[model samples]
Every structure is written in structure tokens, then in C-alpha cells.
Target: MIVAACVKLVDLRPGVDRLTGAVTPSTTLGCSAADRAAVELALQLADSWSAESVVVCCGPDRADPVLREFAAAGVDRLVRIDATGAPDSADVAGLLATTLAGLGADVVVCGDHSLDRGSGSVPAFVAGALGAAQALGLVEVGTEGPGTLRATRRLDGGRRERLVVDAPSVVSVEGSVAELRRASLAATLRAGDVPVEVVAAPGLVVPPTVTTRPWVPPTRVQPPPQGTAALERVVELTGAMVERTPPRTVELPPDRAAALIVEQLRAWGYLEAVPSEPATDG
Candidate 1:
């Protein structure tokens, strides 16, 4: 089995000056959190299945160091697509799809969302371009059988769902699901010498289907209160300063505690009805 993991280098340090609201580049550059999660998942799956793993990235020449970090993390191959200027998310997906097709990858992994844009559209777009089955927000991945893979997805309110998809599928992983392993000194040194195959961006044979709207900040209006309203405001402020109550704790058996938690969650409208089990005739 062959897995291709896509990653993006980002500036994680403080980028915005709080007082001036001016943006600046970070002192250090590293893989985006979501991308690191995807890479870690790919590496884990590759190790468990003894499969070949490749790390793919696209950016300016400055991103070479970030790609090397993936090599140090134990990917069999590192590929860098040399792309300059800011491309739309669709174009980036197109480039990645084309590269993965050339690599003949059986599985493609990517972050659920980018740190910079947070658009959360590239993975789906790449799957569409490759005509591959897609599983988004995956927390865990494992091989089910030959040419088949299982993905465990995280849902809101701590729910999880499992899905199985055929080979040549695309999966986008959530950052909080996994932690990346640290690279050893020897691996880091070896990575410095590894060749990074750079390629030109693929031609935009197909135009992007999505268009972004102009951003407009919301406007807020504040009307001053007058007369007795000021006196009422002071009274209301004083009333709001009530003492807080600490939460009560309860002890119960594990099973009973779980049941009670589930019950309360359902009562609070945080959980839907339990799915009915399939009926079987004896």
C-alpha cells in the first residue's frame, strides 16, 4: 500500500500586533497543526501496514526546510511543488491531485482545514478532482482488508462514527486527534541531504468553481442611556455581582455514571435518540 500525505508550512508564532493590528511574519515556520496531524496519521498507518509513505508539499522555495522535517519524520519520499504567489484553494487542490495521480498513490491524506485560510475545502476538492471516495474529519484510520480502509470520524458532543472506503480514497483529518512524533538527530541530519523533487504548478485546465465574496466588517451602533436609565443601570450592575455557586459532585458506579451522563445529555438536548439496533428474527 502507498500513502501520500499533503502538508503545508505556516507561521505559527504571533503574527498580529495586538495594539497596532498589523500583521508580521513569524520568527519560525513549521507545519500547520492540521497538516502535522495528517502526516502523523499517515506515518502511523504506514508503519502498522508496512506501507510506503510519501510526503507532498507545495509552496515557495522557503518551504524546503518544512518539507525536510517530514522526511526526518520517516516518510519514504519527499516531493515539493514549487509554487509562487498566492493561489486560490481550488488551484492548490488541483496541483495536489495532479501530483498524487502521478505518484500512483493508493491513499491520500490531508488536513481538514488550513491554518491561514481555514477554508476547509481543499481536501474535498481534491477528492472530487481525483474521482476518489472522501472521508472528512477522520480521527483514526486502519486497513480493513486488501484495497479497503476504515476511518473513525469525530462528531460534535463527543460522538464518533466509523466508515469504510475503497482504495484511492481521500481523507482529511482533524488536528486534535493525533500528535506527531519527534525526529531524531540522525534522521534530521539525513533529511538535510535528501533530494526534494520540485515541479512546476500544473496548468489550470479547469477553472475554480467557487468564488469568494468581498469581506465587510460588521458595524455596531451604541446609543447612550439617559435620565433614570442610568440609575437603573447602576442597580442592575450591582445586582449582577451575586456570588457564584460551585458545582455539586456525585459518586456512582462506572456503568451508572455513564448512564446518568448519557441521560442528562439527552435531557439537555445535547444528544439525539439512540440509534435502534437492527432487528433479527430467530
Candidate 2:
């Protein structure tokens, strides 16, 4: 089995101030901790099934570090996608799908979400584009043969659900397997000696949707949430829970809270007032 892992390059640290007419301050997007963990798990599972190779797919601008890490962590190949520094999710997804197709991979893997967008939609979109089944938010994946893959997905309310799907499918791992392994001195020295050939796809165009906006905001660090702040948080939480009820607190002076509650309930389609019946139809 040929298993491929897809990762996005993400900004390690965003800038405090933005420069005029430059690439967006944010750059270098990649797998989150959860994503990394999932990749590791997927690799182990593939290894169990005697996978032919494990490939790490990433963009040219920001893929070096991840590729180096994958090389050190025992990946057979690093598939490079010629992505610009600020390509959006759609572009990345499309590029990834194309790259996997070219690689003749049997299974594709990805982090559940990118650090930048956090939408977690690209993997499914890529799967759909490739005409493959998707098993997302997976914690465990095992394969019986080249054609059959079984995965344990994380479901709502902390439950695990098992799914069986055919290969050439996309699976997004939900968490990091381990800290991205730091490069050893030997690995770093050897990486320079190793040849990395980037397969560049010509004339791949990704169009923008919304207009780009300029202006930047200042950064401020808030105080820790403890002491008086903790008490205030408890009070705020209690107040919010209280607000959810149609019946108001008894402590408030007669009818104000009740009236507000009634107004809210009516607006929310929960209550309607009925007129009293006229006496003797007068």
C-alpha cells in the first residue's frame, strides 16, 4: 500500500505590525499538534499492513522543515507541491489531490485541520474531488489489504465509531502523534546530500473570493483568569445560565424581569399571550 500524508505550511508566529503591499504577515502554515499525531498513527497503521511506501506531501514554499522531519522519521518519499506562500485552503486542497493522483497512492492522509483556517473542510473536499470516501477525525486506521481500510473515528460526545471504506480514500487524523521530531545533526548533514526533486505543476491557478482588506490591530495580553477574575467568571457563567430560563429571578422587583422574559420568549417562538374571554360576549 502506498500511503501519503498531506500537510499545509502555516505561520509559526504572526507579525504584530503589517507592512504595506507585502505578503500577508501570516505564513508557514502546517499540521497542528493533533494533525501531526494523526499522521504518526496513520503511518504506524500503514506499516502494519506492509505499505509499499509512506509519502509526506507539502507545498514548496514551506515544506522543507516537514519534509526533513518526515525523512528523519522514516518516510520513504516527500511529495512537494509548488504552492505559493499565501495560497488559500481551496488551492492547497486541489494541489494535494492532484499530487496524490500523480503519486499513484492507494491511501491519502491529512491533518484534521490546518492551523490557519481551522475549518477542517479541505480533506473532505479533496476526497470528493478524487472520487474517494472520507473518514475524517479518525483516531485509528487499520488496513486488511490494498483495497480495504478500517478506521475508528472520533464521534460526538466522546464516542468512537468504526468505519470500513475502500482504498484511494482520504482520512484526516485528529491529533498530533508526537512533537514533530527535531532534526538530528546527522540528519541535517545527510539532508543536504540527499536530492529532493520538486514536481512542479504548470499553470495551476487559484482565484480569490473576498476582497483583501488592509489595516492591522494592536496586540494586548490579558491578565490571567484567577482570583477576582475567577469569581467574576463564575458569576458571569451563572448569569448566562439564569438568562436561559423563561422564569426570572425572584429577587428582582415585581414584573420587570418577568416582562423581559416574556418578551424574549415571544420573540423566540416559545410563548404567546391569549386574550381573556369577554364576559357574556358584550
Candidate 1 structure lDDT: 0.81
Find the 10 residues in a row with the least total lDDT in model 2: 16-25
Each candidate: what lDDT? Answer: 0.81, 0.68
- Candidate 2 stretches greater than 4 Å from native: 18-30, 56-58, 145-147, 176-188, 206-282
**Residue 205 of candidate 2: its Cα lDDT?**
66
lDDT digits (tens) for residues 88-141 of candidate 2: 666667777887777777777778887867888888988987888888987776
Clashes of each: 0, 17
Off by over 4 Å in 1: 14-22, 156-158, 202-282
| TM-score per model over all chains | 0.69, 0.65
